[model samples]
Target: MSYSTLSSRTVLVTGATSGIGQETARQLAERGATVLLHGRTAEEARAAADRLIATTDVEPRQLHTYSADFAHLDKVETLARQVAAEHPHLDVLVNNAGIAAPERHTVTADGNEVAFQVNFLAHYLLTCLLEPALTSDPGGRVVNVSSALHRTGSIQWSDPNRTRRYTRVAAYAQSQLALTVFAADQRVTAVSVHPGVCDTALLPLYAHKGISPAEGAANVVRLCDPAVEIVNGAYYDRATRVEPAQAATEDRTVKRLNKLADLLVSRSAA
Candidate 1:
């Protein structure tokens, strides 16, 4: 299903200050898409955008910077509002912001496990808030940069935070699983991709060495193209579509996760 070139599209990529997110923004901007670069702080966001212009042929007009600490839900809400207000017709949302679960179990001020909030919940809230802009156009969609490790996760319904039994790996996996399942949501056209084990800060979780962030970002940028038709809820390992963990595609699990996320995000906002 061929559509249009990115030259006419506007995309917002979270976590663009570094790693895959930064590379994704760079690639998209190079292809003529208006890329919004989000970072943990305003200074970081501006710095990433500056570095892109300095090192690449990308023009300053092609980039915009935004910042919000995902550790806080209110900040996520604010970020969404600013983007939606500034760009009414967002063509793509790359939910690429994430962090490895710290060795010591840590909870955000929002009351969610740090990794879970930063990796999944914040994206969930941002996506929901941006629904209007996403659906304003016919081809708009979401690309979730999930992980293969999601297969190792299970949602602890009784205690989502795993406050009783916290392990860094488990906590991180659960967040990725929730993100993968979220693609099944009927509210929007969305897909998740495990962009291979990239040599980013999170690489230690997968291997001693991995591919470059630009290589992984290519897989993500491909999905953003309207020409590369996608099935809603599809999961991809790099550029090949594949089944996600069984639970990720289950309708019951999707609904359950939505409920859990709604509660978690609303509670934090309240």
Candidate 2:
């Protein structure tokens, strides 16, 4: 991809402090796009932004820091409002902040499962809240940090919270699977990517797996390529090629997922 040609766009990347998110920010910055880095805390967000400025060709004015702990629904709302208020014309938003759970269950202040809260639900709510700013951009894009593990998952709407049956790994898979379906349902020029087991801190949560963060993020940079935007909603693996599975093609499932995600969004907003 020609980095110089993409310089005119602006991007907001969540979880920019580490792993694929961090490398994505770096690659985008190198390509001359203004990158707004999001971190769980203020200090980390600032540091991530600084790292981009210090190392890439990104303009200083284009680099920004947004700090929000996604586990808190209110914080996600606040972060959304802040972005729209400050940068009313957003070009792309990447929901990349995620956590893995290999054992046990945890709840957020809002009482939802932790992995689903940050992984699928928070991004869903935030994007819906920012629709105006997003769609306002001529050809906007939203990237959800999904996983290949989604192929082995199921969404029990009656027990979306996993209050009845839960396993740490399955919960994570469910979150990613839900996000993939959400992307299809919203038709919001979004796509879910596995990033193919990047070797990042998230690895320890699952006993360390996959390649390096840079390789895991190669698809992210490709998603930004003009060609990828032309074919939105297509799943891309590490090679930046679309490789959606059987479930990704089911309209009935997509409809069901849309209804489920809508219900969850309304409940959270209420």
Candidate 3:
């Protein structure tokens, strides 16, 4: 893809302190897009922004930082407002912030599973809140960083939080699956991508070999490319289009998950 297409465009990438998110931010910045780098805290975000400026030759104004704890739904809302308040428009929003807690089950302050909240709900809320800004641009895009594990997973509607039966891989897979379903159901232009089992920190405990973060990020950047015509609500494996699991294709489950997500966010705000 050419950098000229991204020039003057504004892009936001979550979990950009390191790994795939960081590389995506760098590449976008290098292409002359105004990149918003998000992290869990202000300090982390600032550090990431500074690193981007130091490493890349882009102007300081071309790279910005925003902080929000995705585990906390309220904070996600706050982050969305802040982005809207600061930027006049957003051309791309990359939901790359996700977690893979393979050790044990942990719930956030909102009483939702950490992986579920971080991997799916947080991005869902953020995207909804930013819909106005996203829709303002004719070529706007929302790229969700999902995983191939979603193919092997199913949503546990009875216990979406996994409170009764918690397992690391199960929760992680379910979260990815939910994200794919959510992307498929959105009215806005959105797509979910599997970053090819990269060597990111979110990888499973037993796995050691995979593609580099830059390689994984290339796939995401390709989806974000404005020059290419993308099929809205499509699922991709790297640059290739692939069918998601059966659950993701079902309109009923998508509606159900969307309603559940709305309830979760509303209850948290209440």
Q: Pick the candidate with the highest TM-score.
A: 1
Question: What is the Cα-based TM-score of model 2?
Answer: 0.90
Q: Pick the candidate with the highest lDDT.
A: 1
Per-residue CA lDDT of candidate 2, range 174-259, in tens?
Answer: 88888777667554788777788777877854455668888777777777655445456777776565656667667888877766
Tell me, what's the RMSD of every candidate? Answer: 2.1, 2.4, 2.0
Ranking by TM-score: 1, 3, 2
* Per-residue lDDT of model 3, residues 1-270, tens digit only: 545557868999999999999999988888888899999999999999998888879789888889999989999989999999998588999999987855677989988889999999999899988888884466688999999999877788878888889888888888999889888865679989998988878765327788999999989998887886788788999989988888888888888888888887773422
The Cα RMSD in angstroms, rounded to one decimal, for candidate 2 relative to the true structure is: 2.4
The local distance difference test score of model 3 is 0.87
Residue range with the least summed lDDT across 10 consecutive positions in model 3: 261-270
Per-model clash counts, in order, read: 0, 0, 0
Pairs with steric clashes in candidate 3: none
Q: Candidate 1 local accuracy as lDDT?
A: 0.93
Each prediction's Cα lDDT score? 0.93, 0.78, 0.87
TM-scores, each model vs. reference: 0.96, 0.90, 0.95
- After superposing candidate 3, which stretches have Cα over 4 Å from the reference? 1-3, 267-270
